[model samples]
Target: MNSAKLSHRSPTTDHGSQAFPKELASSVAISQSLEELGWIPRPKLLALRRLGIETVEDLLTHFPRRHEDRTEFPQFPREESDVPICLCGEVTKTSLRRFGGWRKIFEVTLQESNPNALSEPLVCRWFNLHYVQKMIATGQRMVVFGKPRLRGKRICMDHPEFEVIENDEEISIHFRRITPIYPATEGLSQRVLRGMIYRLLNELPSTDAGLERLTPSNLAKGERRDAIRAIHFPASWEARDAAHEHLVLTEFFAMQMLIASRRADASIRQGEKHCGAGALLDRLLKSLPFELTAAQSRVISEIRHDLAASHAMNRLLQGDVGSGKTAVAIAAMLLAVEGGYQAAFMAPTQILAEQHYDVLQRWLDPLGIRVALRTAARQEESGPLPLFEHAGNSERQEPQIIVGTHALLYDKVSFSKLGLVVVDEQHKFGVAQRAQLSAREPAPDVLVMTATPIPRTLTMTIYGDLDVSTID
Candidate 1:
């Protein structure tokens, strides 16, 4: 609420500097100094931070996902069956065709030579990359790395890493070895990004005294950084492999360290307590037509335990369609109401919110519990009476349940005593939006419900920070 301090400011006056502000540098100076005392040179430490890397321990954990072997040119004729191959070749010719509206295809002729016979050319064709045609001329040599297939009399390479080299002289005899390909973004080509990283590495010497080595000994820092440099602009495959190993190790380590830190932070924060018997929950469950499955009961138990814990609950309940995720959620709402706190259910779509409102009101109305529905359509729908227009006072008076789309989160819709926030179909909401909803006054305990059943491994990796309870 402090507008002056929190408001955004134009950076034009302070935008000229290439590095972070001196104030921010001072803020981390003590940590940087401590790292220096621990044998981490200041230059490397700063460089790591510049690359969004922090902590001496963090430097040791970054690792690469995979490696590319560029040592030997695995020509189409020589490629082994079922073996993944990466090689550089020349694009001898290119042609383009417009199939239909805004659809174009490119045909390219890639020349792969036999190591045993340098003069012979094995023609390879690539399709659908019309932009590549503009980059290739008749005699230009290029580096093409990917899987190769024998198509009729000729070999074809699809979606290959194709790049133009300065000359045949640029092709090193040692290029037939392992290389690493880093994750890259559009507009920022891998080659261009690598060049930027190389330039940053070169600038390390001029950085603060305590910062020096970007990668620590626990990782093959030198090799990986070099591999990153070489794979993008490699003279040989061997150099690329060495660089890849180092890079991969560095990336993996960084991620592991970040996870470890978050886990530690969560351990320190205590959860909230909303403990009670299953009386209200049983009533709600018995009210439904179907009996509670063993899986649903187990997830409800986990959620109940979270609600009764010392720290605020941050849980995800995932289930498939018609799997009774909503039943479990309704039970949780009852528990919140029993504990004398208001509950809110937010849905991504207005139609879904209306459906939830109808279900909740039908079940809870008999129990004399106040249930309100707020939606964008509340102002637009034709009806005998507009409940909102006739409510007299805008402020909520009773300890009730409010079900709606994001309309419930409006500034005017303040709760008397907010406790739990149940977000249905969380994937439809942005991460920041969910956080904002959870941060509502009294800082409600969060229960995210999703119908899509994501794989366990992916869920753990992507939503590891949140406590998960799957219905399936």
Candidate 2:
């Protein structure tokens, strides 16, 4: 969350919420050309533009990735420090040092900003980053943040985030209280970006940010204005988290609203029941020498209910390696076949497709279920895929089950009566590829399987329209 940016508007843009009030749009009118700002030099302005910060919104929204406390200063490092420290210092001397042929380092000698010298000047080094040489000069006051270490006799910090202090006003902004450390580019410094935001924050009104509250005031305390302020310069970490909580909740609520809308659209189209009496599925189960695990059996029951329903089945199946997902999928396919229709099983790669084909044939051949394998390699070696050579006609196609890779998505491959589609490692395919098999007058049940565990919160947001069933 860009705390400074949050001060400008509600999170409507991020989560697909409704447009903000006109008052909010007017607030960001400061997005005029940065050329109007005299403090940033012409070269640094070009660098900022390259980082996509021409407008004021881009500048403010270019949020800080972190925040550091600068209320106190640490002494020059005698040894190395694992954690990063923020320091205010003056550039005592600068030099371009040479090492291995063609390799160079830009070195800056920084003295403590305070008058009384306590230790040796810190040696801040930038190796091979050519642009740093142009920015740093001897006698320039600056603030730098980085982990310090002793390099030979010198105390050194490599590639530290440094900002040249320009004027008296910026000294307090860079030194005291909580300082925002922005996401900086090679040529940009954290101090410069923070200064720009500090000025912008001072210009904007300290109001509620004109946000239409997504959550109740009772549920999340504090106004949008307070939250925005805390994000960039909070009094404490607790304050920042408190300020950030409501905004996070608002974004999440907007996402759920979108998910509900998508779910409603999916339910509008009535589904055709492609499931038949359990004879075919039962036959396959009886043919197997082993019984289904308790988890697999429970998942099968959930899928069976969806297949028998009038609404189209949009479900995700998750199981670990060797968790019997193939068995559940076969059961689903058998049900579709029993209803006098065909099924398609898709895998992400040719090798996986061939593996599934070999297994399907071994199990289904005895039961007289004709399984066909189609892949790009096979299509090149052999002629056209028989299932869709003359797709409109059914008598010419003999396979009750077809297994293939992305080759199944070709226009030539159409199921005469597609009842179900089982996609393994479904995340590898695009939305269109996954849904292509089921896009017909009578929608086929789609069971997408994945071995990768997706966070439950994410599934609710990203795959919100689909019903989720897991084989533990």
Candidate 3:
């Protein structure tokens, strides 16, 4: 939950049954931001953002890919089996040995305090991962999970799922159950992420009152709150699965609600139904040097149908690189022009805007359509932009198709009609920027195009509000 959602108690919950007081619960929500955590540095916060983790909620949602079962350390195996044994002890001897000219092996000997539990010290070995040598310090607690081989009376494990336990608290957290292993980036270590989550959970309000206020109405008050905590630090596999089910269902329900809301909005909002493909579109296609691929043709047909409807088109056009997305976008923009309304094409970068202007100008210039570039780079080079240049004149002038970056959202930039908006590299732009551009016109048809192809399920989850048309 975000800070905004955490502050209030669910109306469905009875205030008398709350576990914690209101003041303490409010303190927990205050630390929702990364900076508020106090442990993370500025550099680390930036790195976390690169991994798509900006808030406490984002960190919690980063579920584990798999778990490490370290509930008990078994005796030296007498026979080979599939299950790997888990051992915990302190590193007694650690070194790097060269096996060949190019190969190096990192070896560490873990000594258990309970001498009677083992015959001798267990030797842990790693290959190629040189960082393991520096990471494993002498006298540090480590829990190694791997298939052990009886190497000449020495119990040795090769490249184990090893963890350097910091203290008694960390060991308790790590060995409590099937431990979660989160997906991580280069600079962001799993240990660091896990510790941060643990600290947050520790500080969070655990009282029934605090949880009742934070949890959603649909979810069971105490049960849902426990599930959220259990996901990060579960006592058993059964508990983890039960917790994960509720969270997964929550995500699915959220997507369903979003899609339903979008459908409801579409039904209520009125839009212009542009005329069918005419001379401008046909001539533009004929003028092209090559033929449109079947994928491109199919997507264009889908777009044409959306534009002809009596509602604003909120569609996402996804295509792979070199899939002729620009050509399809141009054809969609022509539908707006044919209806005697202006259109705007917004790109993420000025360089891309200039490139689109060059391509679109060549195609539409002959048809008497004025295509203009209104980027920050172009405005600074050639004095005032076209919009400002025509400001003082009695008659306001605007391009049929204006191509630019964020400059399109400026106050000086105005459109006569703005029937359609085509945003290239839609992921590069923020939601507010896209909204501002579309807000320029009165419920203009939106055709967001992306060059990078995404999986259908993911696309639906992320961009579920918009209609999807893929050219692949």
Candidate 4:
């Protein structure tokens, strides 16, 4: 078996590491708190971490971006229009269909009194509301809020907000209310998430400083916390709005802080420099097959600025597939070599690394630059060129351009003047691996590349800390 393949085995497949605890203790604590508070238990914290959440702080920062009001059922408008109108009604008839899917349409008879004080029955229909139909079958009264329109002289609501009112409870007739809607995963529905949120809110310690910190100075801490509680189980629209504003601001500010911290770290630290300008870059660009796109040129300018600066450059390059990102990286590496510094390009896969090495040699060799391709394949090759064995001898100097897979990080290989490290498809690498690469002696200027095109909102929300340059 090739040593390269053996070394590349996934860590999860190895049994040598200590076993992870059967259950995450924090998840247990969170679950217990929810049970005590009578709120639905959230998914395990460990599971959430697998979804990218790592801290209690992270949990609180994830706030709903929008809201859907379902607090009251306003009376159906007298005028006919496409806009939704809130109306209160009682279901008079219900039925289910076999093989008709999970959703069911329910027809109800609404009792209303016109100006003459005479009782009139209006035929109202609700579509795809299996749950409402089930409740109606139990002879329960409901207050429905939805847009109303005449369908062949019969009022019908396609999809509407509905709440069942028992004989013991009173119904309110009102409109213009707000209710927070949460983001949810596939198996976890919004209703389920809301139930869990309610449970967690109840279990939250009243004296906890986290809540206090969340509350704005303009609003009383107790009032703010009370608003959050009420929004989950709102008694009024005003309460939901108050809670929503506070929560949204809290989440946005926390995200901003996280991003700011990362930028600060990237800026304040000094990094090894291999500064190059127009002279070397011009030579390489002239040799390339295609012209650099405006986006690529802009990113290259930004990268050059970072390299010339006193502080180390820690930037992420994001672009779509086949967007010529690799060309930009090669240009940067050549710049490093021009400044008499060694450059290392690390790819996640051996095939990709070999591809990069081939391209780098083709481009740099013509310019009289020394480029080396190192990989496990080099160790297994059966020809006159046994590069891996030659590299293993410990006497070889770091080639000007060191191209390889994770083998670039192996202790045996040493760079004469390491100044730049380019990581391709960086998302495939773990955080610890990226950190280890950056910790090399004299600390190389790090440039991370990704081919995935993430939306701007997500880029800021998810990678707020990492300096980003998009080539799109």
| Candidate 2 deviant stretches above 4 angstroms | 1-62, 115-117, 168-177, 184-210, 233-238, 368-395, 398-400, 405-416, 427-442, 453-466
Candidate scoring better on lDDT of 1 and 4: 4
Q: On residues 277-317, what C-alpha lDDT tens digit does candidate 2 reach at each position?
A: 98978888988999999999999999989889887888999
> How does residue 398 of candidate 2 score in lDDT?
58
Every candidate's lDDT:
0.61, 0.76, 0.74, 0.62
> Candidate 3: how large is its RMSD?
9.2
Worst 10 residues of 4 by lDDT: 1-10
Ranking according to lDDT, highest score first: 2, 3, 4, 1
User: Candidate 3's residue-wise lDDT over 364-446, tens digit each?
Assistant: 87887878788887842111245443445755345778889999998888786888999999999998898888764257899
Which parts of model 4 have CA positions greater than 4 angstroms off?
A: 1-72, 77-86, 97-135, 143-153, 159-161, 167-208, 214-227, 230-239, 268-270, 275-305, 308-310, 316-328, 338-362, 368-419, 423-442, 448-472
Runs in model 1 with CA error above 4 Å?
A: 1-71, 75-84, 87-120, 124-131, 146-152, 156-160, 168-191, 206-311, 318-323, 375-399, 408-412, 427-430, 450-472
lDDT of 1 at 266: 55
Give per-residue lDDT, candidate 1, residue 65.
40
Shift of residue 412 alpha carbon in model 2, Å: 5.3
TM-score of 2: 0.76
Q: What is the lDDT of residue 36 in candidate 3?
A: 76
Candidate 1, TM-score vs. the true structure?
0.63
Candidate 4 per-residue C-alpha lDDT over 167-252 given as tens digits, one digit per residue, 9 for 90 to 100: 43111111222334555554454444444453355445545445545535664323444545554544444555656566666667
Tens-digit per-residue lDDT, 341-436, candidate 1:
778899999999888888876787666667777787862211123356445655535546888888876776768777788999999999878877
